[model samples]
Target: MIAREWKCRVPEAHAEGFTAYLYETGVRDSSATPGFLGAQIFRRPLIGKIELTLVTYWKSLDSIKAFAGEDISRARLYPEDEVYELEPDVDVQHYEVIEHGFIPGGL
Candidate 1:
């Protein structure tokens, strides 16, 4: 499996709204694409801004290309992003999933 990671920052006040928007955009769009394995969204509270990271799992690079187009390194953005004062990364990172599993009794 392959993992594609993207990150962005938004003001603390916009965190909630942005999260919902993400689900509607990135998450929903990726979920519908073929070869999309799964996705995880993470948020960290900073001093005054919130950092959000999205890690999407895919079956292969070709599968990713189907979703991200020819340039898989670029981060996909939605038109509504500016409404949340989003500070987004222009590029995304890709990695090969070497090991993955859940520990028993661990959340």
Candidate 2:
């Protein structure tokens, strides 16, 4: 499996709206792709903004290409992103999953 990670920042006030928009766009769109395994969203409170990270799991690079086009390194943005005043990373990072499991009795 592969993990594709992308990050962006938005105003604290826009956090809620941006999260919903992310689900309607990134999460929903990626879920429809063939090789999409799953996705996780993380948020951190910053001084005046909220940082959001989206990590999506995929079966393979080819599968990612199918969804992200040939240039998989580039971040995909939606037109509505401007509404939230998003500051998104221009590129994404991909890592091979060496290990992924839950520790017993640990949450």
Candidate 3:
């Protein structure tokens, strides 16, 4: 399994909008791709900014490349991202998942 993570900071005032955009774009799009296991979004407030981290699970690097294109290390960006992200990283980090478990909802 492959775990991909991207990090960024946005102003506190823009946090909600940025998060919504992330869900609308990354989460929605990734869910539609084959081999996309799932996605998680994390956030925390620091000073006057909000730090956002997006983690996505994939069955393999090839799956990620399908969604991310030829240069898989580069972070995917949308047109409106320029207004929300404050100094977002240009690249994403990928790791091999040793083990993972999740409980489905409706339990």
Alpha-carbon local distance difference test for all models: 0.97, 0.96, 0.91
Arrange candidates by lDDT, descending. Answer: 1, 2, 3
- Which of 1 and 3 is the better model by lDDT? 1
lDDT of 2 at 13: 96
The local lDDT score (0 to 100) that residue 15 gets in candidate 2 is 100
Best by lDDT: 1
* CA lDDT for candidate 3: 0.91
Please give the range of 10 consecutive residues that has the lowest summed lDDT in model 2.
98-107
TM-score of predicted structure 3: 0.91
lDDT digits (tens) for residues 1-107 of candidate 1: 99999999999999999999999999999999999999999999998999999999999999999998999999889898999999999999999999999899998
Sort by TM-score, top down from the best = 1, 2, 3
Per-candidate RMSD, Å:
1.1, 1.3, 2.2
For model 1, the local distance difference test gives 0.97
> Where is model 1 poorest over a 10-residue stretch in terms of lDDT?
71-80
Can you list the residue pairs that collide in candidate 2? none
Candidate 2: global Cα-lDDT? 0.96
Off by over 4 Å in 1: 104-107
Error of 1 at 79 (Å): 0.5
Per-residue CA lDDT of candidate 2, range 17-104, in tens?
A: 9999999999999999999999999999999999999999999999899888899999889999999999999899999999988789
Could you tell me the lDDT of residue 92 within candidate 2? 99
